[model samples]
Target chain A: MQNPAAPAWTADHFFAGARACIPVAISVAAYGVVWGVLAKQAGLSLLEVMLMSGLVFAGSAQFVALDLWTATPSTLPIGPIILATLIVNLRYLLLTATMRPLVRPGTEKRSAAAMWLLSDENWAMTVGEMAKGRGSIAFLVGGGTTVWCFWMVATVFGRLIGSAIDDPTKYGLDFAFTATFLALLLGMWKGKADLLPWLVAALVAIISAKLIPGSWYILTGGIAGSFAGAIAERRRGYAHQS
Target chain B: MLTSPEALLAIAGMLAVTVAIKASGLLLANRLPQTGFIAAWLRHIPGAVLASLVAPAVVTGGTAEILAAAATALVFVVARNLFAAMATGVIMVFLLRMALGG
Candidate 1:
């Protein structure tokens, strides 16, 4: 199917979405920048830094892969490391699905074009906007495109200047991504409605990480929380009936 | 080592598999009404999923770190202000890290 005609990008939509995306992009960019710099410091060539940032386009997964690659007594197979990184980034699958209702079905060309631009912040903001039902798609297109451009630029820039700086750790910029994610999570959480699941998942992750290594945090916590949540909701339904 | 042919092939195969699983499941979900237990379970995905990711980082980092991050989450939860909570936690942690000489 041909692309659906939407409203032209107005100044208002441009400003609105651009404003939303700027801070998100900055946090993400900073994280990517630090990753690039650290990856360089850790022995990635400028070529590797650029290639990974552009092609893989995953920040957290790259970090995990980097950590495992750099670990002292390397216990993991290279294939397993790659696959674990694959699982960590699998949330993108759900992200793409969330975007589907916003875009046309079977428009794989357009979807594929947009896939590289998708990330947690962008997807959440876009989905939240789309859920509101009256915002311009122009906001999404403008903001998402702007973010995609900057993420690459920041990574390359950080790699260039980062080596000159003696201690990137001194600035405490490393924790900013963690801060940003916490902020994002709070905003996304609706109410007391989700508090139980949130607590349960966190507890489960803490236990699982202690038990397993090599990024089992991604799998064990996810499975445990999901299963617990399922059970909890079923009991709630039973209570409502009683 | 990252550029080895073996590494590249591994990455490629993994990506292909991840994409296919997502695409197929999503296609089926669209055709389906998302009713029954699966849909109920799916609703837990976003929170449960993210907490699963974030908690390990905070938790294993130490209870002090976890509590500090929770202080951040608490403010956001209470005030419902995203930037304020994020900024305060980061600033507090930075200062604490500085003081502790970590």
Candidate 2:
């Protein structure tokens, strides 16, 4: 069946996207604050906090950066920090790769600007709308702008007040990262087809995380699991053909 | 306050690579085959990456962590709300750790 007329790339759709993302923006702000607090504890100066959050603009990567941060700049492991960020943010390649349908043809530059602001939350929201046959690039930009604003503000606020919270572990705040990521993984559940990939990824990650002393497990597991998924699908396809 | 060269370089490197990754996806989307093995693999990357991210932490975090992960998944599945599920997991881990004499 032909898709209905695509939504117009107008200000109205933009604002509608922003309004729809209010709840998600709230959650993003919450995580942003957590990251900010952790950044402060990790010996990041206020200026550093602003630059990292403003430029990097990725939650997981920022968090991992903190884990690799050193108190003294002279001894900082710059190479490892950058490498970890690359690995953590590599998932965006997949997230943003599926954006062809959202942007209009011949507008790659503008779409690149929009993609820069794309967070997991807004991307999911925009894609969800696409699945319903009622989304546009404006909607995505609107939602992404909202999330970006909240993240910048909340993270700065957390850094300013970081001194107040000396011990995050006392309140079990450390577990927040695991919990958030767990929920995200659960939210991605499609069906039985996902079982093989997820299992392989998890098992490989568990073993690699122990053997190697870095964030390489994420890269390795992601590659291994995705290949496993593709191979499984190929086999199923062959079975059907036969 | 002035930022160090190391910090600036690190952030710049991160910014460069991240932008490249995000932009490459959109720029290459047109060239990528929509239906094929590559597409199927791309479809699975998000879940696999997430699983890889969360698994080690959950597996090695001890009893409190393991239980909290379960609560996290259950709350997420039921409420379909990310914030609520995360809160439930945090609270469960907190209480469990205390009760078990953390």
Candidate 3:
């Protein structure tokens, strides 16, 4: 199903991707700074911050990690932490699956190499362009690089200045975490189709968080909610077909 | 600066799994079916995960948090800006906490 004349990766597309990400980059920097502040409070050292933002490089998972982090080494929940990262990032399977068209058969290795840079923001932008018949691997990488730079710099900067702010709640910084996630959830809205799954997820999470000790609520809620969505969508499809 | 060995190990683990998940999608795309229950389930995962992350906190928090969340949603809808909504929530929580004497 490959377009025979699909244009090759080029400088123009790369820069265009970067330029297109400029506005999204602002938001990336915003939450990045917040993540840094929270990470510092969560007791991550500067070197750890650099390593995480540089290597792990996923925003939502990184934020979830902070919630799971503990300052004391003896009490650190390494297993749950790793499990949470995997569960939270599992959605990438779907995101990157949509990019298969851009990967010609032989270029799988090269394209997979670039998956490290893939992010929800850039992926959405690249897909938007793809709809218009104007996307390439270069464009996706360009946007990812831009978001990466912003995330790194902003996070480090937040960690630096975060030292000065002793009491986060006094300045409502604790609320910032909830606020950011709430904003993100709102941003994911795709009309009434999302209503059921979100409600189910919210209800399950709230109940599980009360009963369970660790972050298992997140995993349960995500799986349960997504299954609910699939079931609902299937019912809607059968109704339409019939 | 590096902290404990455990921390390093955990971060390394996180890096490994994250890379694996991202790579598997592109590599396995051809083999996976384009549509079906699995596809719909996968499509809903990100939003559901995010909702899971946010909902518990909001439900468990004090009055200020619930009110601030509403404000955040309102500001986000009006401005369509993440940062602005966050700022609004922060400022609202700060003021509400003071006014409500909590």
Evaluated on chain B only, what is the TM-score of candidate 1? Answer: 0.61
What does candidate 3 score on TM?
0.94
- Encode model 2's per-residue lDDT on B6-30: one tens digit a residue: 9889899889888888888877766
Clash list (residue pairs), candidate 2: none
Best by lDDT: 3
Which residue pairs in model 3 clash with each other?
none
lDDT of 3 by residue, A1-242 (tens): 44345556789988999999988988899889988998989999999999999999999899999999998877888998999999889988988888878875466788888999999899999999999988988899999999999999999998888899888788888888888888888888998999999999999999999999988999999989999999999999999999
Give the alpha carbon lDDT tens digit for every residue of A135-241 in model 1.
44456656766676677888788778777866644665445445555765677566665777778878877887788766566566666666677677778878888
Ranking of all candidate structures by their lDDT, best first: 3, 2, 1
For all predicted structures, in order, the TM-scores are 0.73, 0.88, 0.94
For candidate 3, lDDT tens digit of each residue in B1-102? 568988998899999999999998988987877778888998899889888998998889889989999999999999988899999999999999999989
**DockQ of every candidate:** 0.39, 0.62, 0.76
Give TM-score values for chain A, per-prediction: 0.69, 0.83, 0.92
Docking class of 2: medium
Question: Tens-digit lDDT track for model 2 on A86-107?
Answer: 7677678777877766666456
Find the number of clashing residue pairs for candidate 1: 0
